[model samples]
Structures are given as C-alpha cells and as structure tokens.
Target: MPVEPSLRVAMTVEQCWQPAPGGSGTYIRELLRAYAELDDLSVTGISAWHRGSPPEDGPLPVPVRRVPLPRALLYRSWQQARLPRTGGADVVHASTWAVPGRRAPLVATVHDLAFRHDPQHFTPNGVAFFERGLAIVRDEAAAVVVPSSATAADCVAAGIEPERVHVVLHGVRAGAADPAGVATFRARHGLVRPYVLWAGTREPRKNLPRLVAGFSAAVRAGADLDLVLVGPDGWGDERDRLAGVSADRVRVLGRLPATDLSAAYAGAHVFCYPSVREGFGMPVSEAMAHGVPVVTSRGTSMEEVSDGAAVLVDPMDEDDIGRGIVEAIWPGAHPALAAASRARAAQLSWSRAAAQTVAVLREAAG
Candidate 1:
C-alpha cells in the first residue's frame, strides 16, 4: 500500500463553543473527527480565547490553539482589520465565513447565503457582517466551498466566480437507533405510537408556523400519526400559531441527548422538515439514515439530501405541506420508502466528506 502525503490544516472551530451551536457546530466537530481518521491531513483547530472546552455533549477531536482576543473582538478583527494572520498551516480552512487574515492560501466553507437570499432573515448588523464576509470570500479566498449546488448557485449569484466555487455535500453520521432507548424516550415524553417527527431550531427560517398548520391539516385529513417537535428554542413566538393547534395531540419535547434523538429518528413514522430553505438539511439526511420516510421542501437543499426518497412539497404552502405529510404516511408506502431512504443515506459518509475537503485544501495550497 502507498502512503498518502499529508498537510497541516488550520481549521476554525469557534462554533463549537457557541451556546446554541447549530448545524455549523456539527460541521466543525464531525469534519475534524473524520479528519482524524484519515492520513491525508493533520488538522489544528483555531478559535478565540475561551475559558474551557466546548460543551459536554461531545469530545474535542483535535488540539486547538487560540488567537489573542475574545470572540467578538476576534470576529471584528477578522472582518475589518484582518489581524493575527493564520500562517502555521499548509492551508487555512475558514470553517464558516468568519475568516482569518490570509497569511496562507485560504479556503472557506460557506454554509449558505441565507442572509443574501432574504435580508429579513438576519438582523441589520448580521446582514452587514455577512456581506463583509462574502466580500472577503469573493476577493481573498483561494477557493470557496459550499455544501450544496443550491448554495453554490446562490454564491455565484452573489458574484463569486463559478470556477472558484466547489460543492461538497455534507456527511451523515447518524447511526442505528436503539429500540430499548427509543421505547424509554417515548414513555418519558408520553408520546403516542406512530408519531411524525420534526427536528431543528425553532426559527423563522425553519418555517415552524406553516409546519404546525400543515400538521394540523394532516390530522384533520385522518392521518393517524401525532406530531412531535424537537430541538433547541430559536427566535420565534409560535404561541399564537400553536394556540390554534390541537394541544392534546402535539408534543413539544425540547432538546434531547444524542442517544435519545437518534431514537426519536428511529421511531418516527414519517420525518417532516419543510423548512423554507437550507444550505444542507442535516436532519433530513439523518432521518433518512434512520430509514424514516421524509416529507421536506420541494426545491431546497433538503429535497436534494432526500435523494428522491422523500415526499416533496412547497414550504410556503401549508396546504401542500399537509398533502405531502399525508402522502408519506399513506397506506402501503413504508416498505419501499424506508428501503430507498436507507439506500440514499448509505451514499453519505464523513470519511468521504473529509477526503473531498482535504483535496480542496490541497488544491488551494498548490
């Protein structure tokens, strides 16, 4: 066997310390762990000075070295002053667009151009910050990596050259769910049998209001499954919407530990994630990996992640979403849909994502 030449990688991991640590945090952790299993590269995590390790949810996969400032100051410095250059590696990978000074060839992963798609999704300052980051990516980055063709199209529309853009789909790390743990999870939450599952932050972009409405419609149409919601509370006042919903049937089980979450996926009758948009819908792929038939948005990245194994609907239409959910759980659908979901999910793996990322980083360095 031949040995693969390796390069040192300085990859930003600041998202790991964030309080919410959404999908981007997952990206940093999973990619580094995948990198550790490979001989193609050696990665050193980069973050601002912080008191302790990342939250207790998981272990750190790589050693980290810090910059001189706290998070806010460091982010400001990167966007405007471009200080404390990233020079200790063969190439620097800005895990998100909050890039460091370009002391080495810089390759940046842009999760999505959500801010650009609709400025209202972000605060005024957030939009400005993202604009600054995108400008830097356009002018300074040796390569720009995106998670989906949908996001790649958005990047080009925002004026990044097509040739510099690379689409690298995210990996699925979801494992088989435990039956005993799943039963316990159901009992603990007072969940009824054959429930439809929805996971992800409760934000405007997640389109929860419409999901709730659609779910109500599904129930009205005589779909037997109850609806179960999971994940951390994001910004939104869904009270008014949920008030009209059948409170007795809907269960809002907030965040769970990873084991229980996988159990939730394992036990779902249908996984419904009709968010308005996504760069890559990690949860949808995760649900599919668990062999649950999915109902997701028709044209977004979630549809791509589902790989034709899911039922697609227009996210903007509560009625269409309702129809899709009903279809997914319609009689005589589970066996084939579940089989396809597993097959499509089998195609995604972290080792593959790690190798593709290393190739891009090396291309930037070369």
Candidate 2:
C-alpha cells in the first residue's frame, strides 16, 4: 500500500487586528473554526508583531506565531522583496493577499476585486495595493480561491488562469441569540416598528446612499417599517444622504456585538442588503440562516446567494430598491421565502467548506 502525504498549512491572520475586519475577517474566523473540526491538515496562523489581542479570539482554530516585523513593513516586503520567508509548511495559504514569499506552495483567497467593479469607491493607493496583490497571486500562487463565481470571473479578468481559480461558498454560523436579548435590542435601540435590517462595514461599494433613499421611498409608500443600519463606519460617511431621511425613521446603531447582531436578525421584518457588488454577501446568507426574507441586489453575488428566495432589485435605482424593500416588507413576513432561505442556507455547511478547502490544499501541496 502506498502512503498519502500529510498536509500542513500556514495561513495569515493579520486582518484580525484591523479595526474593521469586514467580510474577510468573518470568513477567516468561520473557516478556521471549521478547519479545526477536521483532522485532514495541521494549520498554523501567522501574524505580525502586535501589542494587543484581536477583538474576538474564540474562533481562531490554530495557534498563531508572531513574526518580529510590523504589519506595514512586512506587507511591503511580501509584495516587493518577497522577504521574511514563510517555509516549513507543505502549503501556505494567503487568507488575504498579505502573502509570504514563494518559499512554499501558495493558495490565495480573493474576496472581491471591488475596486475593479467600482473604482470610485477606493482611493488611488488602495486600488494600487489591490492591483499589486493580484499581480502577485496571478504570477505565483498555485491556486486562487474565491467566495463566489462572480469573484472568480473577476480573478480571470485580472489575468489569472481559469484553471487556477476555485469558487468556495462560505458557511454561516447563526449566533445563539437569546429571546430576551431580542427584546432588549429592540428596546435599547428604540426599534418600535418593524425594521429592515442592513449590516456590514459602511463602505461606498455597499451602495448605502441609494439604500437610504430607497428606504425613505418605501416609508412614503406606507411600508410601516423603520430602517436599522448596523456596522462600523468606513470611508465616505452617508450623513449628507441622511439629510433627506427623517432621523427617527432610520437608526444607525453603529456596530453591535455578536449577540445583539443576531438578535437584530432574529427580530427584523426583512433583511435588506443592496450592495452593488460583493464576493459572497455573507450578510445575505446570515440573514437567510436566521429565517428572514431578504431584499438584495440583482445580478450581483447577493442575487446568487439568495438563489431566488429573495426579492431582487436594481441596485442603481433608488426607486427599484425601494420597491423591492416594500415588497419584501409589506405583505407579511415571507414564510415561503423564509423556508427556501433556510433550506438554501442549510446546504451551505462549514464542514463541507472545510473539506473542500482541504482538497485544494492537497492539490497545492501535490
């Protein structure tokens, strides 16, 4: 009998310390936890030297070792000099693009090429950073993993070989939301009426201006629902957009804790995410897992994430977005859609994602 080779992986965990961890942070945490549940590979996390621990450390599945260098210098070296070698592992996974040198087989995860989709949303430096990262992955990485087919297409368009691209759907872990917490969340936030919930980092690509306008239109149409926004403030604050919207009707609760976020999901009338583009739209999947009907953008990855269970709208058109929100809100909670949402979300399992990830690691290692 022939012996199979053991798989060992070293992955980057530097994003955990970023102020706004965003979708990639959630993806990393969930994937790592799921990876721990499996025995196929031994995983080690790598981070730049830092003083404080990450905000949420429970989901880090592997022991992390800190390199002596700081983040900014380390990233620059990875892109240009390819210094600070990351060896001693069969394969190295750049969970984000802050990858190590080509000392080991590499697999890079591409969340989205949002700058390519909406260049106006990013600063020149940010766009250049992404461009540089893509060039590195397209040239050196053995495999490029993306969360959705949409992102895979973007990677191919950026000149990566189609054979090197793999689409891995993310898994959702619904929080253990207490019922009293739901009531407290509603009371604490003054969510007196049925509210449409939107969550994620408040970045421009998320299309928040249009959402604010659309929610107001929905209110004018007598949808009778407040709009609750949950997320940390990213670039381009939408305060100017909110000038047209009544203050009481739209509650920007800022970022909430995991329990409160889950409670928000559990208590919402409808979850609305009208992002113009996304890699996978984790919020859509999370909302669906919580048994909520969703309203998301059409023709983006969120549309694919919804799988026809959500009310889809034109992300560019405030009228259309408003119409979608109203339709999702007015005629009562969408029991049929909720059923389909749960059914679809059920099929997206962390265990399955972990197994598929291992298979890709094996391929890279081989």
Candidate 3:
C-alpha cells in the first residue's frame, strides 16, 4: 500500500496533558493520539510554559515543542505575534482559541460560547477575553471546530457564517475493565453504596445547587442512595450551596485519574448531569458506555449527546430531576433505554473524532 502524503501541522494549546486532566487537556490528548496514527499527517504540538526550563517530556505519539513565556498575558501576546516567526507547517490548529499572528492557515476548536451566553458563570475579565478571542476565531480561522451542534449554532449566532463551523463530537479512550479498580475507587472516595454520579466542575452553569436539591429530595424520599460528585471546585457562590448538602448523602471526590474515573462510572447506579448548558456533556456518553443509566438535562447538547438513550429532564425543575433519578435507579426499570444508550456509546470513537478533525485541517490547508 502506498503511504498518503504527509501534511506538516502544528497544534497549539495553553497547557500540556502530563500534569493535568481538564477538558482541554483531555481534548489535546485524544487529538494527539488520533493524529499520531495517521500516515498522512506529521503533527507537532506547541504549548506555553516558563522560559529556560527544560521542556517536559511524555509518552505522546506526536513530537511536542514547548515555547516558554513569562506569564499568561505575555504568552497570549507572544502567541498573537511570535508564533508566525517559526513556521514550517501547512496549517496551524489552535486547540484553545489562541491563534498565531501570521502562521499557516488556521483551524480553531471553539468548545463553547458559555462565556457569551452565560456571562454570570465567569468573571468580567474572563467573559471579555473569551468574547474577543472568539470573535478572532470567527474572523481569522480557516475553519472552526465545535464539539456539538449547539456550539456550532452559537458560532453562527455570534456572527460567524454557518458554513465555517463544523461539529466534531468527542469520545472517551478505550481501556481495560477493572472491577478491582472500581471497588478501590468507591472505597477511597467514600462511595459506600449504589449512588448517582455527577461529574463536572461546580460551576453556575453546571446547576449544582439544583442537582443537590434534587438529590436531597430523592434521599429524603427514602431512596437509599447517595450522590457522588467528581470534579475540581469551580468559581461562583454556588460552591457554598453545594457544600451545604448532607455530607453523608453527597460525596465530593474531586478529580480522579481516567482509569479510576472509568471504574467509578461503571460502578455507579446511574449518572445524573443537570447542567443547563454545555458544549457537550461527555459524562453522559461515558456513563452509558459503562452500561450505566443516565439522567441528563433536555436542552442543548445534553439531549443531543444522550440521543434518547438517557432519561431526559427539565433542568430548571428540581422535582423533575429527582423523578428522573428515581426512575433511572429503579431496578430493572429501563432495560431497553439502557441498551440503547450503550449502543449509542459504541458508535462514538476517538479515532472518528480525530479523522474528522484532520479532514478539517487538510481542507483548511488547501
């Protein structure tokens, strides 16, 4: 077989994956892994870090080059001005909104327009920065990749042409099934019995307080269950509200490794995600892949990603969310629904996401 011609491409991000596990980090990791397997593309990853420090190395499949700068402000300025200074690529992909000044043609992945649509979720400066940066993406990027159709619609709503945005869904990495890992994760996180899981940062848009209320109501109704939250603490006064939930009934296991996280998903009675908005709710798909039922919000990408597999509820109504949870956890309740969810999850793969992304990059280069 003849090898496909390789396109030299540079992928840029704010941080490296070796030391973190946020959404952006996960996105970069999957993207790199997918690109590395492509015979038709040679990819190099660039990131912003400190100067004079040796670049951190990892087991990434693609070549990585870190450009050190003094601070985030300086790094942003450098990215806008100096990235074009050392260019030898057919295209540059901005994994997180910072584009090089005059480099090769660019493709940007705009995960969400949350900062614009829900300004209350972010700081004033952060909202302003995202608004301006997204505008740059709309005007300058050769093409913009969105994680969901909702985000693609947001791009169009923000004045970008509909033709310029592409929706490329993301997927979880495949791994070995580990029952021991599941048990260990439950024990370490104080997840005593069958419980509903909510995985995401405690942000306003996440609607954590509402979820707490819903879960609390379920427990009070004698649902012999717990609500486990897995994510780092986020900004906003809502953290206090979530903290107020009964500690015995609400377990907060902040950030776990992928292996343990997968185990947690597998061990759960059901996954409940009631966020009002999102680029895509990955946890819903992930939980379904583990053969666990899911209860998620109805609007935005939650319903789209769930794809009739999970229990859908109105996020604004605590009673509805509670009812959905009760139904999901009811023993042998929705075998057909659970089966359909697993089937849907089987259709999503990181390789497909990578292929779609590479296609966009090649098209942009042309």
Candidate 4:
C-alpha cells in the first residue's frame, strides 16, 4: 500500500500540562499516544505558560511549544485581542473548544453540551464560558469531532452544519488482569468480593445520589453487596445521598492510581454507572474491557457505548437501578454477557480513532 502523505497538525494541549481531574485529560493523552504512532502525521502540541515552563510527562515522541502567557490571559486574549500561537501548521486542533485565531483550518472537539443541558452541574461562570466558547466553535471551526452520536446530534442542535460533525468513538485499553494485584487492592481498601464498582467524579451529572439510593434499596432487599465509589470529590456532597446506608457496606475511595483502578475493575462482580447524561461514559467501556458485566442508563451515550451488552435501566428510578444491580450481579449469570462486554470494547480502538481524526484534520486542511 502506498503511504499517505504526512499532514502537519498542531494540537492545543494546554489541558494536559497538569493532571486531569476528569476524562478529557485522559482522552488528550491517549489520543496523543496513538497519534505519535502514525508515520503520516507531524504533530505539534501547544500549551500556555504563566510563571514557569510547562511540566513534562516523561519524553513525548513529538515536540511541544509553550506560549509564554497565563491561561486566563491567553483565553481572554483569544476571545478579544490576541491569537494563539499554532506554529503555522496546516491544521490547528483544539481538544475542547479552545479555538485559536485564523491561523489554520480548525478542528474542535466538543466533549459535551452539559453546560447548556444541565446548568445545575456547573457554576454560572463555567456555563457562561462554555456558552461563549461553543459559539466560537460552531461559527468558526472547519470540522467538529464528538466522542459519540449523542454529542454529534447535540452539535447539529446547536446549529452547526451536520456535514461538519464527526463521531469518533473513544477506545478502551484492557490491561492484563493481575490476580495478585486485585487481591492486594481489595485488602488495601478493605473492599470485599462481589462489590459493585462506581467510578468517576462525585458530581450531580453522574447521578450518584440516585445510585446511592438504589444501592441502599438493594441492600435493604437482602442483596449482600457492597458499593464502592471512586474518584475525587466533585461539585456535590455525595454523603447526602447515602444518609441511612450502613458505613461498612459503602466505601468511598478518593482516588487510586491507574494500575490499582484496573485491578478494581477486573475484581468487581459488576460495574454500575447509571449516569443521567454523558458524551461517552469512559468508565462503562473501561469496565466492559475487563469482561465485567455493566449496568448503565438507557437513552444516553452510556447505552450506545455499552452496545447491547450492558443491562440498561432508567437512571432516575432508584428502584429500577436497584433491581438492575441485583439481576446483573446474581450468582450464575450468563457468562456470555461478560464475553460480549469485552467484545464490544474490542471493536473500539485508539489506532482507529487516531487515523480517523488525522483524516478529518487533513480534510479540513484541504
């Protein structure tokens, strides 16, 4: 096969200079890792600096250019008086609505329209910022990339041209299952087997209050299962949802390293993520990649990502969520469900997403 010509691509990775409190950071880093493998792409990463140089995450396969401007100043300037430095590349890609001035063809990734759809999940300032940023994206970007069909539809609803929207499903990496490590993680966190795992930030959009209510109901129904919540404290007080639940059965682990988190996924009897809304539920796919049976919400991208393998329940109904959890974790459940979950995950790959993203960037460049 003849090799495709290399495309000059400049990506704004200011979000990656620090640890990502959410999935976007992971998306940026993983996409970059896959992009680095392409011989037909020359990539440049751009970030802003305020006081000191940008922090490095080991050695990247590509070069990075740090603009000597604070984040606030850069965003303010980009919105009004200044332009982001893109090093004159053919295509300038913003990971999440951080578009630069007219330097190159723009490819913007709109993670979600949560700011508009669910204002309660964000601060007023945050909603305003996204409302303004998305306007720029819709008005100026040559191509728009979304993680799921749901977000693609959102783009069209927001008045972006349908032809300009592309849905590139995110990939999942299933690491080798470590039995010993799984045992260690359980012992370290005092977690028992047959626990339902809930990963992601504790936030309103995640619908943790309902999840906790459902878990409490399941326990009340004599289902002997523990509920483990992972990730950092987000906007809401999650404990308010766990009002009457027994302390011994519910574990709140703030955060664990990737290796341990993978082990937790592999060890769990079932993974539960009944989110109210999502562009793409990374935890659901990640759990599926580990051959774990999943219970997620219906009528959202979580259902799309699960692809008929997971048990879908109404996210708002605590009783329905509770029943779904009981059925999913029942003894001698269909082994094929676990296999199917992994199979669904196998179909989504970072290499494929990277190649498609590069193609979109090339098209926009032309």
Candidate 5:
C-alpha cells in the first residue's frame, strides 16, 4: 500500500477575528474557508485575541489554534519566537508582517509598503511598526506574497529579491441584489438619491479631503450628486476634513455588513476610489462586480485592478476626480466602460487566490 504524504501547513492570522468584517479579517476568513476544502493538506491557524475567547469548537476541515497575546508588542515578539513552536507544521505562512524567527520555509504576505513610502499619511508609531516588521519580513521570509504587481514592485524596491515575490489578487464575495436591504440601509442611514460611493477606512492615503473637494465641486456644477463614505472613522484629521463638507451633500455610513454593502454598491450611480496607494484595491473589484461604474486612481494598484474598466484619474488632481465623477453619472455615457468593469471583476475570485497560495505553500514545503 502506498503511504500518504505528510503535509502540514501553518497559517498565521495575527490580527484576525473569526466573526469580524474588516478587510484583513475578511481575507483571513475567506482563506480559511478555501483552505478547509483541500483534500491532501492539514492546516493549522494561529491568531491574536483581545476581547473574547477564540471559538472553541471548529469542525473546520482543518484544526485551528488561537494563541492569545496581551498587546501588539507582545504579539510581535511572539511572532518572532513562539511561532515556530505554535506552527509545528512543516510549512509556515505569515499573513501579515509578524515573522517567525526560526523559519521553516516562511512565506510572508506584504500588503503594501505604504507606511514606508507615505510616512506623512501615517502616525509615527505606525511608521515605526511597519519599518521594523518589514525588516523582519525581508530578513526571515523565504518568499513574499503581494496582492498586486504594484505591491510586488514595492517589495522589490524595499530590497526584497524580485524573484522571491509573487502577486496574488484578492477576491470579492459573490453577492446578489438585495433591494429591500438596500432600501433599509438607505433609509436607516438617511441616504437620499443621486449619490456616489467611496468605501474604505478614512485614512489620509484614502485622500478623503481631496474626494470631498471634488464632490463639492461636482455638486456646485449642478450635478446634484451626494457623496457616501463607508468604512470606519479611524482617521482624525481626514474625518474632520470630511465633516467640513456640507452634511446635506455628504453621508458617512461608517461600516456596513457585506449584504448591505452590496446593495449600497448597487444603488450608487458610480464608485469613486481616489486612494493614493493600495495593495490590490479590493473595493474597486467589488464595485465592478456589482455592475457599478467606477472612477479610480491612475497609478498604483487601482489602475491595475480597474484595467480600463473604470475612469482612471490623477488622484492628486481635484479637477480630474471631479470630472470623472461627472462623466460617470451622465446618462448613457460609458456603456463600454461599464461592460468592461464587470468583465474584469468576473476574472477575479477567491478560489483562484487560494489555489495560488496553496501552490506556493506546496512548493515551499517541498
């Protein structure tokens, strides 16, 4: 009888919560869901805990183990030391910058080097954390996984070997139109008609101040368009800038569940993401999947993700962003653009990303 090959894989989830709904959290959830279905692999997950206990019972196709750390500092130290013991498996994958000191074919995912390149956009602590973590990633990780070729380039520019970097795109969850949900979300949020949607945390890099300026300009031009900003209110200065805009013309919806977010996307006339930097820009793909016309940034991952499906603008140019929004809202303006957006979205899927990730793990294990 042929013996079954021993394949054990360890996946790190440093900042993920099992039931949370943020982007990184969602990425971990989707990755685990896909990894669970693989036949020949035994997977283990390690994560950080703060508020509640980690879920105990997981009939999850693979075993999941959560290691609780007191704080981010402790977590980083644990990542550098305790990970090898925690991840007793043959291969280890760090989803974020939390690198293991004693590496056994380590694969690290570098979302973006934004904190390095755009220090003005981040807090001092954030910049320091990224610099330190990235140093560990460069020194320890055998291969680096980036969400886009743009990010891969960023990694190479940061002194990582280009050959060691791989680009694996993120996928949006498949969702159907929910009119009632849409109406409920709109009503609850006091959303009126003729709105453009911008979804993401209110970070300086999101360029919300610029977006507000552009939107206000469009509104002044008799566009009569409202702007909807969805995501968390983590940005102090950016939030204040957004608040300075006319409240009647701008609605900040904080964060919404996936279902409502889909409906919100469906209801929007166009999705505008003028982020100055991004790893993959999942929201752009999500907007495309929902058949919403999109206007995004020209350089960085936004352009690569949009693939001519959406209007590409100079993010720094308020005039360009405003004009893009106007063109998107004009009736029967860009049929080809809309069609291409959906086509581009159709090509991106979570399964493909998982398959690629698994292949990398398998290769590294060998």
Candidate 6:
C-alpha cells in the first residue's frame, strides 16, 4: 500500500516581517501563530523579498524561507518572466495582493474592498494596481478568503462566484491587562485621565479628521476626555486632520509595542473607530476583547463584527460620533455595553480562525 504524502503548504508572509503600515501584518502573524498548533499540515513560510533578514527572534511554529530578492525584482521575474518561488507546495496562500503563479492551488485573502468602494482614498496608481491585483485573484485563484461577510459581499459584487468566496472573520486574543505596563504607557505618553482611544493608521478611510472633530465636539459637550491616537503615520499629513483640536487634549502615541498596545486598549475609557469602511475592524474587536466600550461606524464591517456590542454611529457625522463618545465614557451610561463587548469578543479566537482556514485549504487543495 502506498503511503499518503504530507500536505505541503506555502504561505506568503513578507508582510509579517516588512515594516509596512496597517494590521495585515498582525493578521498574518496571528494566523501563522495559530496554524503552528496544527499537526496535520506541513507549512513553509515564504518571504520572496526583504530589506534585511526576516525577524526570527521569536520562536515560530513553522520553518520560514526568505527568497533573498526585493519585491520589485520578484514581481518582474515571476509575474513577468519566470516561475515564482513557491517552495513546491501542495497549496500556496497569499495574505493579500501578491498572488504568484504555482502548480498548486492558490488561496488569496481579500482584506477589504475599500480600494474599489472609495477610489479617492487611494492614489490613481494605487487604485489601478489594486484593481488589477484583485482581478487576478478573482480570475485565477482557486479560492478567495475574506475577513468579513461585508468583504465577501464586495467580492461577489465584483463578479467572483459565491462558491469561490469564503468569509473568515479575523480572530482576536484578549490577553490579561498589565497594570504596570498600562501605567508605564500612560505615563510615557502623558495620557490624561479619562481618554478616548482611536487606534489605526492615519488614513482617510479611518476618518481621522472627523474623529478629531467628534472628540472636540464631545469635549465641548462637557466631556473632559483626551483622544489617544495609536498608530503609525500613513498616507497624509496628520496635522491636517487634527487642525482644530487643542494639541494638549489629543495625543498621537504613534504605534506602540504589542504589549503596550494591549495595555493601551485595556486602559482606555472607551475605544472609538469611526472608519468609513473596513473588511473587519480588528481594533474594535481588540478593544472589545479588553473590556473597552466601543463606538464604531454604522453600515460597515464594524457593525457586522461588533454584533451590537458597540454603539453604532454615522462615521460622517461628527455630532453623532461625539454623542457616541460621550455616551461610551460617561461613568454609568453603558456598563452593559462593555460587558456585552467582552462576552462577544470571547467568542472570536485565532485558534478558530486557523481551524476554519485549514479546512478551507484542505477543500481547495483537494
């Protein structure tokens, strides 16, 4: 009798190592961490290009191979001329846009459809590249994975067959709050008492300008709360969005280390993410996981992921956002909301996401 061969899977994780902005890095890192726990599959982490050696300081669950080439070089070589370095796996998984040619089936994760829905949010060149990349995923990939049902809908709307599209919500871990770390973070950032937190890249889709306006409006409405923006600089000038807000009341505690970030989430009086759109609002779920009351945009992925645990507000309306913030931080205004948020967060976990993803891969590979 012939023995069954192992299922070799190649996963593109350059984003996990690159110093790129946004949470796609976290999504890939966390998914890989969870995948490491599974035994039935043999996974090879692939980074086709890197500025330096991939960070291997942390003990990874699987072996990683860096292709020793830059992204542009690889794109020109594989996309235009040669075969990609997919490690001869039974399946190839790309976390985002870099879907390479391979003998095995390709699985692509579509994080969001913001590029299509709001082309103005991106440069014309950027929009063109995304449209081309997504078209490739739809036309060529064996299966497409999305972080939210909203994103899945977007894919179908864009002409992807429903059967080929899978909705896999992002899993979040709610770790224990470190009081000492939280204190250090607050002191280091000089965060005043009772601050509202907003964490995301400072991009237009995040609606930072409106968020700032809402925070200011809340302040005028008798809420003495500072707004803590935790993320890296992205796309545009931060000062433009923060034009009218008093500098002292809003602190941009640019991206914190993971532990410190978790502590920031735990320490906040409330977490508000009024992004105009999202595939899955990871920060909202992260805040909910930490028992932080949340206020997020309505009719978007935030509403889908939060599942009524968060106060929904029109992201475009500063007054509505301001009201939601006021209601969130007011001592006795929404105790049950936070409790519900914690409960809802507990239901979402990376282990589950990994299991679902593995199952999807198995079906796609077969």
User: How many clashing pairs per prediction, in order?
Assistant: 0, 0, 0, 0, 0, 0
Clash pairs, candidate 6, are none
TM-score for candidate 1, please give it. 0.96
For residues 1-366, write the lDDT of model 4, one tens digit per residue: 997788988887777655443777778778889987888889987777744433434444567776778777777777665375465689989887566665788899998997778898888877877887898898889999999999999989999999999999999887666899899989998886479999998888899888988988888888888898888777666646655587888888877777878888998888999999999999999999999999999999999999899999999999999998887877666476788798999998998989888889999999
Give one digit per residue, the lDDT tens place, for model 1 in 16-74: 88878889998888888888788778888899997789883555778888887999999
- Model 3 over residues 68-149: C-alpha lDDT tens digits? 5544754467445543343778998888756655468978898888888789889997786687678678778889999999
lDDT of 2 by residue, 77-182 (tens): 8888987888889999998878787578999999999888788898898888888888889889999889899999999999999999999989888887777989
**lDDT-superior candidate, 1 or 6:** 1
lDDT of 6 by residue, 203-303 (tens): 78899889999989999999888899988777766546586678999888787777888889989988999999999989999999999899999999999
State the TM-score for model 5: 0.91
* Per-model TM-score versus the true fold: 0.96, 0.96, 0.91, 0.95, 0.91, 0.94
Q: lDDT per prediction?
A: 0.86, 0.86, 0.78, 0.84, 0.77, 0.83
Please state the error at residue 13 of candidate 2 in Å. 0.8
Please identify model 6 stretches exceeding 4 Å from their true place.
1-5, 51-60, 78-82, 85-87
lDDT of 1 at 219: 84
Candidate 4 lDDT score at position 319: 96
Could you arrange the candidates by lDDT from highest to lowest?
Answer: 1, 2, 4, 6, 3, 5
lDDT of 5 at 115: 84
> Which of 1 and 3 is ahead in TM-score?
1
